[model samples]
Target: MRKILIITGNYGEGHKQAANALYKVIQLRQLNYEPIIIDFMEVTHPLLNPISHYIFINGIKMFPSIYGFFYRKTRAANSMSEILNKINNLGVSRLLKTIKEVEPSVIVSTFPLAAGAVSRLKEHGYIDVPTVTVITDHTYHSSWIHDNTDRYIISSEYVKEDLQSLGVPKEKIAVTGIPIRPEFCHNLSVDPLRTKHGINPSIPVVLIMGGGVGIIGDGSTTIRALENLPKKVQIIVVCGYNDKLKKQLSRELSNSKHEVILLGHVDYIHELMAISDMLITKPGGLTTSEAVASELPMLLFKPLPGQEQDNAKLLTDLGVAFQAKNTKEMIEVLSFSLFTPEILNKMRGNAKKIHRKWAAFEALDVIDEVQNATSSHGTPMEMNS
Candidate 1:
């Protein structure tokens, strides 16, 4: 089997999730391809990886405005952003070593820095394998644009245009939607899942996720706001590997009037999404894509400044999502929407309209095509533009 090296980072879960989705689709389809995922930072900067990871996670939580400022300032291809991308290409030597050891037929990057590093290596003629960069967010950043990248897999045509405006050739872009888990492609029976999870099928099920890092902009505050709703709803919160938050929520919501189920790092988000009448979560690319795939309308809560804000705006414009600016707006939106079935149904219908349920398969097709074309040429794919 030809190896497909999937390079990702853990700064946020969307990159890793996108990588895992590609890996799963390859395995599920029984393709004659071996998918290997590596945390580029972990492998390249082993000692500093943990420290950097902590700062990235906490930095967003502690100082979101600062993070947002940099994120916004670096969106365009300016000299400062160029320097930062080059600086971000710190692990190029280590990445080259990894490529030598893995001998992959193609390199797929879900993280922007990883894509930049691979593009740098390919530009210098260090490696010839085809490179596919999957943009995990609805927005485009200069870091994700690399001259030597063979293909750009993006979530939508809007992003394709964004890249085109940034000078990336149109032929090098593929609008495959953001690849999501294969399980989300199929429609699961909601009633069974609700019963299995000890939830009432009759009541509205609101699924809340804080993304991978469990930073949901004050989970306790959000829950209290939800509890204030006059309607009775079943709330399911997926803490996502945050033990401290889970334990704290457990204590806080123990005496809640409504049934609230708390979970930590569940592998069954598809199931939860299946049974959910609506999702109250941060608008990360992967989670929102999964929610869209599940045909679940979303009440996006306090999206961070950057890709998330872009995602929230896109979803809202698409009519599949509503944003809650703060605790008061969240309460008002949930109360108004939950009590009215037509509102939620309209959003759900809108979600179904844009859902790319087969995005993973589409991405796999791109991977297969790139590998086959390169193999037929008997050379590493080079950027003609």
Candidate 2:
């Protein structure tokens, strides 16, 4: 049986979520292949995991200016590439030893760290596997591209242009939408989903998500804006892993005329998406893809700097979502959107236009291509540095 290694990191939920979606698709195809999923951070240098996570999460939260400085520095010509190569080579002996044992025919990376690690292994002649990168964001950064990757799976056609501008060959990139769970593609009637969630079918339902972290600092502001709307709307606020935020939202909206359902870490996001009329979220790639698949329009609020900002622009350009910089603007946008059926319908239509109904299946097809290329050539492919 052929083996494919799917590598991701826990720095953010998008990479892991994208990796999991690809894993499920490959497994369901039953293609006489074994798929192994690994968190690269966990496997490579355990001592660095906590430090890396802290630097990523808290660095963004507490010191965004510093984070932006580092982010910008890393994007300079070959700066990030050199840094990653050095780190990958630092643990070469251990990493090579691990790869020797696992013997994967193909390597798929959802995180930049994995791509860098695999590139190092290939450069050192330790592994001959075909390497493919599924960029877990709508935009491409220099860090995401490595010299040793064979192909790139990206989210939008616009990203294809971005990669092209960065000197990546057009042939090496495929716009596969963003890989989301197959459940998002499943057809669930809105009425049934509303009934299941105990939501009123007559009133429009809005889903407010702050990604996996559960709470964005702007949650209160967003809630207040929604509360100001003239129409009584049902709001389902998912505060992922943040109990304090859940309680706060519940307490704040307790006596309001609008129905506010406060939840913490729910598994059935697809059901919620199915029932929701629209989404108010920060534009992480995976969440955006899921929203599109559910045919739910979005009002993106206060995207964190870097990739999210890029994602927001792409969604806005596609006419699938709106960006609101502050609470008052957010409320005005929502009020106008909710009251105008044509606007909502147009946004939904645009979302469907860009939606890849078979993203998971298409990703599996790319895996098959890699497998065919590996089998027929029996030679390791090289990516230009």
Candidate 3:
């Protein structure tokens, strides 16, 4: 069986999630191909990976300004960003070894660092395998671009234009909405999901997600603000992996006027999303993509600088979501949406227009196209090797 090596990282969940989405679709549909998913950092830097990952997660939380500063500085392919991209090429030798071991028909990268590494390999004429970079965010960051990458799987036409402005050929980019889990791609009956979750079908259900680190806002400020909305609504807060935040919210919202369901990390986020009318999230690429897939309108919280901000801009520009700078703005947006159901319906319509529910399948088709085109050139290996 032919293999597809999917490289991802754990610095953030989006990268890993995007990679997993592709792996899942390939497993479910492509019987002739085997999908191999590997955490690039783990294989490349086994010892320092964990420490660096810890620093990365905390660095964004403790000093978002600093992170945003760097993110902005590196948005374009300047000398500084190029130098950083070269620094990201640290594990090329190990990566090349893995490439040889796996002998994947095509290589896919969901993490920019891994993309840089693979691009370096192809640049230096070490590997002839076709490479596809699935950008996990809607923003145009120079880090995700490389001279040797054969194709770019991007989120939308906005991202396509952003990349084209950076000098990447438009033909080289495919606007496949960021790959989300297959479950979110399908339409489920909302009444059944609401009943299953014991949610009131009569009131609006707002699903709140802060990504895995729970970076929504200070403790329960956002929740309290939501509870105080003039219209009574059911709030489902998914505090992913943040035990402290979960416990704090549990204590604080125990007696909320509106029904508040507080949960820790959950695997059934798609189900929760299906039942909700609106999503208040951090605007991470994966979460927003899932929301769009569910046709759920969104009120993005004060997004951190960098990709979160960029993602927020894209969603709002597309008319599928609203951005709130703080709790006050959050309340305002929530109240307005609650009072105006038509606006929510319009947003859902916009979401339907752009949402690529089968993005993973579409990405697989791109991979197949690239592989076939490469085979036609007779450069690397045989198709049935």
> For each candidate, what is the lDDT?
0.88, 0.81, 0.86
lDDT of 1: 0.88
**Tens-digit per-residue lDDT, 1-385, candidate 3:** 8788999998788998999899899988955889999999998788889999889988887899999999999888898898897677665677777777888889999999898888877776678888999999988788889999999998988889888888899889998889998888778887787779999888988888888878786657878887769978898999888899999988988888888888998889889988888998888898899999988899999888999999998899999999998888888888888668799899999999989999988999999888878763214322111
Q: TM-score for candidate 1, please give it.
A: 0.96
Summarize candidate 1's per-residue lDDT along 160-209 as a digit string, tens digits. 88899988889899999999999999999877787799988778888899
Stretches of candidate 1 off by over 4 Å are 376-385
Clashing residue pairs, backbone N/CA/C < 3 A, model 1: none
CA displacement after TM-score superposition, residue 123 of candidate 2 (Å): 1.1
Residue-by-residue lDDT tens digits, candidate 2, 144-200: 887778989988888899888988898889788878988887878777777778998
- Give me the runs in candidate 3 sitting further than 4 Å from their true place: 376-385
TM-score per model over all chains:
0.96, 0.92, 0.94
Tell me which of candidates 1 and 2 scores higher on TM-score.
1
**Residue 232 in candidate 3 has what lDDT?**
84
Ranking by TM-score: 1, 3, 2
